[model samples]
Target: MDQHVKTLAHLFLDGEEDKALHFTEELLNEYSLMSFYEAIITPAMYYIGELWETNQISVADEHLATAICDFVISQIKGKETVRSGNDQSSGRALFFGMEEEQHYIGLKMVSESFKAHGYQVRYLGPNLSLEHSLIQINKFKPEVIGLSAALSYRLPGLKEIIKRFSELEWKPLIMIGGRMARKFALEELEADQVMIVKDLHHLSKWFEEGREGLINETS
Candidate 1:
């Protein structure tokens, strides 16, 4: 990383909100928004989580760190495209959850990662009904759709939702990931892709590979 980015990461790790925000904005001005997300914010978030896990930071501190990180991300404006441009007709995805699954941190990170990789993201907020999900897919017409299932109990509902999508003429590349995805076996969910993301690197690689395959096929 460059000097400015290294400083920004330290500020975030030290929980210095004001300094970090200023640094992030400067980085945004100097680099592509996607670069800031993929290279800066994503990695810093991983560091914060690791710090918390090792008891080096308090829960309150971790929460504050995430809030500050989110604040910086929210301030970012402009094209907001990842490796791709603003062609909604191309490289599209809908990321959301099965009904009753409430955790959103992982989903939010996944959404941001997808956007950073140039995929046009239609992020459906948590607890979306099957009807609402179908509506968004029909409207966006994305190439891929992902559902978050954080709870084991909601797997049946998730399966039904996947089944409905499969039945559609415009069936997307369906994928599932989260705690439930990790705790359970892949054969159980029966998704086209069953993923358990341990960090942003894994998430980034997955999207890049998926997008490359799509491009190759289209080419």
Candidate 2:
């Protein structure tokens, strides 16, 4: 796509962690945190996924790229202060990958996005079991619960998880995201309590336009 994204993708695929981090820092100077995620890093990782899907890269290569990307995200996050106007009282949010779903870079990005906007976030990373997730949900009692899945096969499990979460009396908002959310028509999963966040850009709009009202409704 864009030159920066292509170069960043190359860096990730090459497993140049230091170079990738430097490139990411340069991008941060040009883009806001959310925009950097939406426009640059996201597209680069998607390109890496395309390479893997088309057999242009080995599974080990793909994992290397993912590891580099993860390192870059962590480096950037470590250096930045929270955005000035955000309120820590925004509310609590818990994020995790669906059972058996191991792709969690997108989930990590989503958690950081929420943190940038000042939400209290618990990012449990990938492949958390339903029983464990419910235990955290019951204890955290977050206003929003975000789940991710990258593969199509996880759809049935995703639906089942949503169903169980819906039955909770507090009725936390359920947010579905990741590659599956973008590639498939997930409108069937959307209801008064469920939302499909297609990308970081969409999530930013939700924070700006809908977050407060939805949090109040859940509260």
Candidate 3:
């Protein structure tokens, strides 16, 4: 909410990682990394996209903005959140992008939302091979595995990955979210836990409602 935080977030959106990191650390120390992200960074990203779409900024500038935001996000995610007081741990979730799908911003945002809702989020970063990802799933044993695909064409590859996982005898709740999932619809994916994302707020609300682990049964 502070003007300086907004300014720093804009700087980050404009691809100024050094300045963004400095400001992020200051605010994070005062508040929390999640607060800095929600209050400034996310809004700044939307603003940057708007500027680019409206021709106020160039494609190169938009890419630069994304780079800076990713850097700042890495910084924020490195900082731990306040521990949930509940003795019973909520389910663990893993988020990643399919191989050849370079976009990870959506995955990052959704992972943060899950974490805020008390899920242990294991973020595997971007462009991971299906084999490597399955190894991660086996290693971490998360209750949910979320794959994010930015483009629609990547859906088939994502499905292949899911099929590979299914063969492993132990399959986690596989949720896919992003532009592809939202537009193409999750019914087409045939995954047991697919959900269409209306927006970040909707995703957050869904996670909150399901934090107790009975969303499907109640519905």
Best by TM-score: 2
lDDT of 1 by residue, 1-219 (tens): 455555765676677878887777677666665456657765666666777899988888777776666666655533355335654534887898777766565677677656655677888867889998889899888877878887777767877887787776765777677677666764544434333443455455555576445333323
Error of 1 at 119 (Å): 2.4
Which has the better lDDT: candidate 1, or candidate 3?
3
| Of 2 and 3, the candidate ranking higher by lDDT | 2
Model 2 Cα shift for residue 58 (angstroms)? 1.6
Off by over 4 Å in 2: 78-81, 85-87, 212-219
Sort by TM-score, best first: what order? 2, 3, 1
Give the number of the best model, judged by lDDT: 2
**Total clashing residue pairs per candidate?**
4, 0, 0
How accurate locally, in lDDT, is each candidate? 0.67, 0.86, 0.69
> Distance from true position, residue 128, model 3, in Å?
1.8
**How far off is residue 212 in model 2, in Å?**
6.8
Q: How far off is model 2, as Cα RMSD? A: 2.9
- Per-model TM-score versus the true fold: 0.63, 0.91, 0.71
Candidate 2, residues 131-214, lDDT tens digits: the string is 999999999999999999888887888999999999999999899999898999888888888888888888877877786564
